[model samples]
Target: MQPAVVAHRGASAHAAEHTLAAYDLAIAQGADALECDVRLTRDGHLVCVHDRRVDRTTNAKGVVSTLSLAELSLLDYGGEIGVLTLDALLGLAADHGVPLFVETKHPVRYGGQVEARLVELLATRGLARPSTKEESPVVVMSFSTLAVRRVRALAPRLPTVLLLTQLWPTLRDGTLPPWADHTGPSVAMLRRDPEYVARAADHGHATYTWTVDDPADVELCAGIGVRWLATNAPAATRATLAR
Candidate 1:
């Protein structure tokens, strides 16, 4: 089977990352899944923003947790797009019938409240747990083992992905943390150790390689039997893999 094409921060290469416009473009491009980074504002509203501070992606400064949702709405992302709420993003995904890969941003002021609130939000939408894999449309991912574990505790049926930036002792064998249902590795890590993919598969773990915008990297991932390919260029990646 062809690997599922997951859009990283929507079709971010063509539009502002995490904006509704980007997500709409990703759906139109036929991405199998949409990925987003989740952060909590000071007033406890979950938002779809990648950076700790809005300065990088928006026209404002200061940490996400230091600003209220209303305060965040005043800033412009990429000068034209406004900040997107997690709730609004979910609605867009639901409307398009595309699955969501939610990445919980780390070092937030909220201790474990991020996961808790995420679970609550999904539960409210009747999406926290699904009776079958096809029925589930959301997956929680994080670089923090603790964060993923928290998701497992609160929403047992929700799939959890452990994102890897660098090889750690616990994951040297291509196994994930106990609570993680899948593994997400950076493209560089997979390129550095091609065998890691097979090792992970041997351990019954599904490997998803991220931010693969290059054609060669896409070929490498397809050759390694990765189950998911997260990329900014989903249309091109899907076409290349189809061949």
Candidate 2:
């Protein structure tokens, strides 16, 4: 079977990362799904930005949560590069009939804002759905277990992916990390331990790794039975999977 390919930040390698343009390119290349990081603006709107601050991706200089969506929109998010909002990204996904895998960044600081807004958006747009055990699509993933759990509560039908960088001693801990009191284990440790994957599966959640860019790492993840591999280089990873 062909491993599913998710476009990390929407074909970020060719276009500006996290912009609508990047996402469109990824879809044009026949990607199965689109991935994005969600952050809250000052006015409590969900935006498609990876960094906590806009300095790197935009012309603005402030925390994303501190700026209103109106302020953020005016800041040339596409300044010489890529820029997009959660709404725009979702709209594109809907138009292309592609699935979305949204990751909530800095869930600790944003509290329930990101999840709440996401639920509202999906509900309003009629994008939320229940995935079968064999064909779960449109997943919501996060390093924060709490965020994932919150999403589950808000929309039980929607599938969730637990993003990790390390392993935890307990399955419940997978929902919250020690640093942020958020749940979820690390993908790094799961790659090294089969038991970790089993534990995550037992909790009714799928495992996915992030920022994976190496062929060997992709092979290792595939060997470990991870359902998703989030990578910056989707085309290269897809080629590796083809082999």
Candidate 3:
């Protein structure tokens, strides 16, 4: 089977990352999944923004945790795109039938409140848990094992991914952390050790790699049986995988 092509922050290479327009273009480009980074606003709303601070991506300059949803709404993302709420993105996902990989940013001021609010919002949208015998439209991913565990407690059926930048003690044996359904590694890890993907599969974990854009990297992922390729240029990656 062909690996699933996930848009890393919604075709971010072609447009501003995490904006509505970028996500729209990703769906148009035939991305099998949409990847997003989410954080909690001071007012307890979940918004799609990558960094802890809004400085780099928006007109405003401050920590995202310091701003309320109302205050964040006043800023322009990429000069024209408004700040996106998790609700808005979920609506688009439902309308387009695209699966979403929602990465929870860690070490925020809100602590576990971020995961709690996220599970609540997903429940309200009828997505907190997968329908019987079906994969959920949404999967939660995080670098923090605690965060992934929190989601498992809140919604057991929702798949969780443990993101790794490098080989860790937990992964030296090729097993996923307890309660994690999948393993997400950097593309560089696969390059350094192509056997890592196969080892992850041997231990009953599906593997996904992030931020892959180069055609050679795409080929490497395909050859290693990566279940998902998360990339900034989903259209180009999709075409590459089809070859």
**Against the true structure, whose TM-score is highest?**
3
lDDT of 3 by residue, 204-224 (tens): 888889989999999999998
What is the C-alpha lDDT profile of model 1 across 88-193, one tens digit per residue? Answer: 9899999989899999999778979999999999999999879964468998999988998899999889988899988888788878767887888899999999
The most accurate candidate by lDDT is: 3
Q: What value of lDDT does candidate 1 attain over all alpha carbons?
A: 0.89
Error of 2 at 169 (Å): 0.4
TM-score of 1: 0.96
Question: Model 2: residues >4 Å from true position, as ranges?
Answer: 78-83, 108-110, 129-137, 172-187, 198-205
Which candidate, 2 or 3, would have the higher TM-score against the true structure?
Answer: 3
Clashes of each: 0, 16, 0
| lDDT (Cα atoms) of all candidates against the true structure | 0.89, 0.71, 0.90
* TM-score for each of the candidates: 0.96, 0.82, 0.97
The parts of candidate 3 lying over 4 Å away from their true place are 132-134
Runs of candidate 1 exceeding 4 Å displacement: none
